[model samples]
Target: MKGRCDKKAHLTGYKAGDKLWVTDPTAAAGETLQWTKQPVPEYRADHPSSPPFLRYGHTATEYAGAAYIFGGRNEASVCNRLYRYDPYVDKWSRIAHGGMIPNARDGHAATRHGHCLYVHGGYDNDMEEFSRDLFRYDFREGVWHACALCDRWEGMHRDFHALSTVGDKLYLFGGKSDELEPYYSNRPVYDNHLYVYDPAAERWDRREAKGEAPGGRRSHSAFVIDGKLYTFGGLNCLAGEHYNTVHRYDPAANRWRLLRPHGRPPPVRRRAVACVHNGKAYIFGGTSPLIGSPMPAKSPAEEEDEPPLVDHSDLHVLEILHMAWAACGLPVPRHDGLETRPLLPRPTVGRRRPPARPKVRREVDHLRRSQSIFVRQRYGAQRPPLSDRHQ
Candidate 1:
């Protein structure tokens, strides 16, 4: 795709895998979007389906023409099942991978580096503890393994953070940490620091990033496009506010810029899944801050922490070429606790037929030609499996 993926945030459409949508070039001709979800086949016994409960902190990444879903929580408990969805065949399969499968958990970040899926840092609901360990799942060979980190966790453990791959290094940012504080509080501790992991070296370096940095946030979304890293919409534990601001990072130069786009931006949301397709940034269903909720109290005496959440199934698309927000003509989905973050890169596959509208494709193509795009930059070697050492 000529369009870059550096743009952040997403679109409205399928909230819980029901609707498939694209922007309405017509609306943006002065517009936003008109979207529709594709029909998913009925559930199968041999194969796994996108279950309603196992979505919290789970991720979906596109690889080798298929989208894979990894570890997340169901209502009753966390699961380790790995499911794959094929757009071309309209089918789902439960891939059986052998080796040291990571413990089932939620709020973990999964990223594709080479042929393996790297899962790190999540809350082990069963153990009632947080995990900062890294595990590797090799798709081609169907094996789960471990990585050689600097230490047990290599650093601290966090959940609801964002992980994006730039070349071979993985950039992990933000998330809620329980390690901080005086306890007896319901609120979370948020992290703003950035950590870069190099697979070849099997080490992580905490970079002291300079320039305009994004404030501490968790459950945010990020993607690297055109060699720049972009972030948007995360929860601020201290401020007690979900963010709407967008920031861009130039890794090579180590700088940050606040992105100011024109037109309507999506309302403040958290846990929204973000991805780059063609050239636009897609934001799917997420939890929006409850309107008319009481403000957080300033002290322990008048403590207030609960933020009522609203169901959000709308799909919103951002035109990366222009930094403007638009819409897709799909009804906002109605679902509570829709876990919609990508643990994998979202490809331009599985998208239903675009609405027969004029100027949409043409305009997008024009922008593609005019602006730079984010093409995949392969970095680092494939993570070695545990068997390598014994061999």
Candidate 2:
């Protein structure tokens, strides 16, 4: 959907497991967030019966036709159930579940390459303990098994490290390391270390770096495009600030370079999810520090200027080739690569029915409540009376 340019972020909307794309709400009709002429659909679970919900301690990775979410802490407790979302059906299915199930934890890392999903360290319920044991999930056989941790990284079990796959190997860089001894603090820090896991050899190799790498940090997001790893936005350990800088790592050269991101860089935010589709990177649903002190008024002043709105729903996209970073954004000197295409599609299922308005829930009226109460909860609260708000 086109939106006003004044808004700084783009966000996605989800209904019944279907995710829809829209321009930044804060952008002007033609100026601000400009969505593609087409919208892409994200995968949904096999079962659509469950109300849409967000849970913690879960790890999700996108593959051919499904997004797999497994082993996360929900409102209830740490769960081992495995759920797969199908973009075609717009539903979720709980499939086979058996792996070297690690202890229940959150903020872990999941990266898929070839056929296996590599699971890494994360925090436990207490938020004190961190796990380092590595697990592998085989998609072909639907089995989870533990793999050996690098002898070099044997001591500390950390979570929230930047996880990205380059070529057939997986690279994990910088995150909060777990404390193994009582004398040390189990706090998150900016780790400068980089480790590579070779699935073929089933071993971790510490890369020999010749240049600067992204500083030690956590909750940052990273994804691979055309064999290079691109990362941006994450929380650093400090009074509280989100990063806006972008960086790329080349597995071939064993080096890193900061890049100037394309589109409007998303506001400095942390703990957001980002994905690569059709050679572009899309990020959404993150929290950032407010730019100024919040006005104390209970509500907006009807007579004064309108206050800006904020939510964790802003969506941002980076056409990787359009991004102008040094050593980035250039056409290949050769033409041997595969033709690019979008990984997902726009959803067609679960269409929205026009609001059965004229029915209001005002304390003084009852006939205006003909539609389901839940629908009102979802869209009615923000609009004025139906007559005036309808477009």
Top TM-score: which candidate number?
A: 1
What tens digits encode model 2's per-residue C-alpha lDDT throughout 98-141?
75655555567888888877788765433224566688888888
| Cα RMSD, model 2 | 16.3
Model 1 scores a TM of 0.72
Find the 10 residues in a row with the least total lDDT in model 1.
382-391
List lDDT for all candidates, in order.
0.59, 0.53
lDDT of 1: 0.59
Using alpha carbons, what is the TM-score of model 2?
0.64
Highest lDDT model number: 1
TM-score of each: 0.72, 0.64
